[model samples]
Target: MVTLTSSTAAQRPDFAAIANWIKPNSKILDLGCGDGALLKYLQQKHRIFGFGVEIDDANVLGCLRNGINVIQSDLESGLSGFADNSFDYVILSQTLQAMKHTERIIREMLRVGREGIVSFPNFGHWKNRLQVIQGHMPVSDALPYHWYDTPNIHLCTLGDFENLCKQCDAKILERRVMKQDRPIRFLPNLRGKLAFYRFERQNKSPKSTQD
Candidate 1:
């Protein structure tokens, strides 16, 4: 089995932070799970049981190699295969911006799991702003793509994401804005390169089926 320690988790800071939020032995559904690295790490460390959803053919094979149960499917098609509240957490990491139906996906995530976690690049970072002022798209370690080739179609700031969560009736439970592995306490929206959020549907009930 592939083992990930705290030191290696630091390389992907979000994974470490997210792991802190999850309880041991919890069921997790990871969407856009690239190579099942996170899920594999979680399983080895947290003893988590569940599946991953990945669209890419190579990624699905990677998940298999990593000993993860994965569903090969497009996220835009919706997560109808899973029943309501089937898992402890549903995670979408750094892939929310590329989603075509963002709100729908969030709603589905909440409907299928007790809580949801999302992470994305912060478009409001000062470096990105400076690049925009210079009439060129920002390209950094967090968002390493040129204007035309970027997969991120819905780049947004911290504020934009919070507002969208409100619209979707998802209550923000915790938020971490950071530069790589370090937390930015001051002016996070402006200085942070990435954003991580933990949330759940507001007014949700254990027996409720309506989304």
Candidate 2:
């Protein structure tokens, strides 16, 4: 059994809104898990058997101290070691923009889990749009990157992500947009700071599946 230190247990967010959507006692994989906060929260609150995959050494150690099980691996390499359908849900939160191969990573997430939850900063927020029109990079809470020094390999909008989901043959089960901690569903594309989506790969016909 894992044993998390008290100091490590105090940094998690109130993910109750998202946690409510997940099935209780489900096995979960959290990719790019920073500090393993979410994983610990899931374990304590939902009785989930959560696994965290993180690349940062400090964060990996922090997860261990927090009594969370974690695997240190680069997201760019893909989750090849895990068998298909190994988890009930695979989560990627706030790390999609940092990946160069977003589609491939998402595909692997779907293959390894029955369902996937993905959340990313929305580049189409009204403030971001306004900044673009004014010929400046947006510096908001969601996107704190400047044009010169930023880790984001790809910057995408809500519409862009939705189109990509359709093109990749993934079905969107749910979508939530948030500003700060409040839900903003009415005009998410224009107002939301973050966009969250729950998705599953569409079942293919036997012939297509074989191909």
Candidate 3:
């Protein structure tokens, strides 16, 4: 009998902010939904019907114990299981950078869900540039991995992500940049440590599907 809780103050900050964007009773699919914390919070707060897709076995168990709906699967293989527009929203929180097939997964996200929300650490921050100039990989609280051992394989900047979105014909509905959970408005690429975007496909059609 395992259960999860988020009573402490130092818990991750994106759950509440992301919850604000979701409408009540709207269906949601959360990719990489660790321990179902954010899904649980949304259920308790917004009463939205939600499901989680997690790869880790421990996290799958945690989701079950927490009474959250979850599926265990690797993200890089792609999301071909869901139907077109099966959900009102699909969320990818802090998992985009580590993915090898970012473009493919993103396209799948938009295909399976009407709108997709993604958050990732911004690699274009000024400090990262400074570290490169000084000949050392940047290691910050948001991106705490050495270049050689980092899980984030395809890290992208704000500009880089925007260009990818354009290539995918994704319409950006909302954008937020932050420094340690607080908002970052001025010189976001240089100052912001985290970035979030909510978007939808300009044209609605499904390409990849699974039996």
Best by TM-score: 1
The lDDT for every candidate, in the order shown, is 0.90, 0.82, 0.86
Q: Output the number of the lDDT-best candidate.
A: 1
Q: Where in model 1 is the C-alpha error above 4 Å? A: 206-211
Q: What is the TM-score of each candidate against the true structure?
A: 0.95, 0.89, 0.92
As for TM-score, the candidate ahead, 1 or 2, is 1
In candidate 3, the residue pairs with backbone N, CA or C atoms under 3 Å apart (3 or more residues apart, or in different chains) clash, namely none
TM-score of 1: 0.95
Per residue, candidate 3 scores C-alpha lDDT tens digits across 1-211 of 3332454213666775687688999899999999887888887767889999999999999899888999899987777778889999999999999888888888889889999999999999999989989999889888999988898888889999999999888999999988876889999999999999999998877556333
Candidate 2: deviation at residue 206, Å? 12
lDDT digits (tens) for residues 98-180 of candidate 1? 99999889888888999999999999999999999999999999999999999989999999999999988899999999898
**Where is model 3 more than 4 Å wrong at Cα?**
1-10, 209-211
